[model samples]
Target: MLHTLCNVESGRLSRVEAEEEFTVDQLAAKVGMTVRNVRAYAGRGLIPPPRLVGRTGYYGPDHVARLTLVQELLGKGYTLAAVERMMSELPDGAMALGVFQTLVNPWTPSEPEELDELQLAEAAGIPHDPAIIAKLVELGIAERMDNGHLRIPNPDLLRTGLEVIKLGVPLDAIFILLPKLFAQADAVAKTYVELFRSTVWRQFADAGLPAEGWPEIQRTLENIIPLAGQALVAAFREAMAREIEVVAYEELGLDPNTLPSTG
Candidate 1:
């Protein structure tokens, strides 16, 4: 799905992906939104209109990406009115915005599933505690629906969490640690973004973001997103090894340096 192209401005090679398209219903499912919500957003100019063929309409991947963004922003309390204004403010219109959005979105998780409280309780093998359900909703893991079903966003995350809970880790302890983890991750993420903005993006902006240079910008941003994740994982592994050595030395009078090492 990846293809190489030359940036017309720089005459340098870059890569882009084949954009996927979907129907309204599929688009709704992709981003965990209702069909009505998608239609409404399209009606209000929040998203671009679909291409028409015969009587059916089809939305492109950009539309799906934009909806994902809208879901995240709205979950964080951004109103539709505010979102519309912000979308309008993007440079060089929707095409640029689409590529820009993909680069900027922190993470892309899988599609969600709608499960009732009873279903979730059974899946996770836990009691149906209202307090815990409320907390989950607050954390954006799930959304309580009008029909009393819960929309589990990032179902894989929920599954992993359930596995840890089943291993006897207290949910309360996990919740207490979540904020600190998020703060550290957020700080590291901002550092990477600021690095891009100050250097690569700054030069692009200085040149006025010429349309021909978009492919290079897209290429630059797309490449960094995964590299940032890899870098974080590497750094965390190194730090954890050091921490583990210290913990073992202090608690069990074990020194890793004295043990036979494997290369």
Candidate 2:
């Protein structure tokens, strides 16, 4: 019997004997995949071909790990082609699997919620105005379902909109500002994405991404998510302050010296 240390939490093996083997059916059962799927994966080079053992073929721990990783990636909305490409990018090892897992794990803190039309309207502090609801959908603030339910992708944002509405901001004015805000946000997002691609991803790609460097690449990605969020918020705060100051001076006829320094 070959010894294997399975980390049940991650459904990955921390350590396993290379010689530990299973037949296709057994391997599929162990990895929670269908035997046909296992064969397909082998056929497509998603998993390595089993070792020839006389008349039968036998797969080992590496196959198990790879299959588990594939299932994980697929669960996270990756297509088979994308998973194949991602797998090809990493060196073959358990560490690579762990790194990819971390890289693909959910980074956002919020989960989307499904709400009825009344609930959504209540959240937005708005009456059942089809035009306004359609506007919200267009803004990507909420998604309308075939069942006439609403899926709020970010409840916090919805709550913020309600608060703004409560503060006497006209719904029309809010809707008018959303597209401009979204455009600016899209541009900012592109800049950050390019920064990550040019810096961390470029270096890893150029270095050929040795197994030893996987942790560093993973760490860089993990760090970038929260850091990028912080940077965006800080920049927005500064920009908002500056704009408010200008409005106070120009439109409100307030003295520049009387306004607080945005800097």
Highest TM-score among the candidates is held by which one?
2
> 1-263 in candidate 2: lDDT tens per residue?
00011112222223345767999989999999899999998888887677897989998877888899899889656999988876655445566566556656756568877888787677667687778778888888988877989888777777777899999999989888878987986797678768877887777657655445657766876787788889989988899888877787887776767766666
For candidate 1, write residues 144-237 as lDDT tens digits. Answer: 8889899886787788888988999998987777678768978997898789888977787677656666767778778887899899998888
Off by over 4 Å in 2: 1-106, 255-262
Q: Which ranges in model 1 have alpha carbons more than 4 Å from their true place?
A: 1-80, 103-106, 253-263
Q: Model 2 — which ten-residue stretch has the worst lDDT? A: 1-10
CA lDDT, every model vs. true structure? 0.72, 0.74
TM-score of each: 0.65, 0.67
For residue 101, give model 1's deviation from the true position in Å.
3.2
Q: Per the 3 Å backbone cut-off, how many clashing residue pairs does candidate 2 have?
A: 0
lDDT, residue 66, model 1: 68
> Of the candidates shown, which would achieve the greatest lDDT relative to the real structure?
2
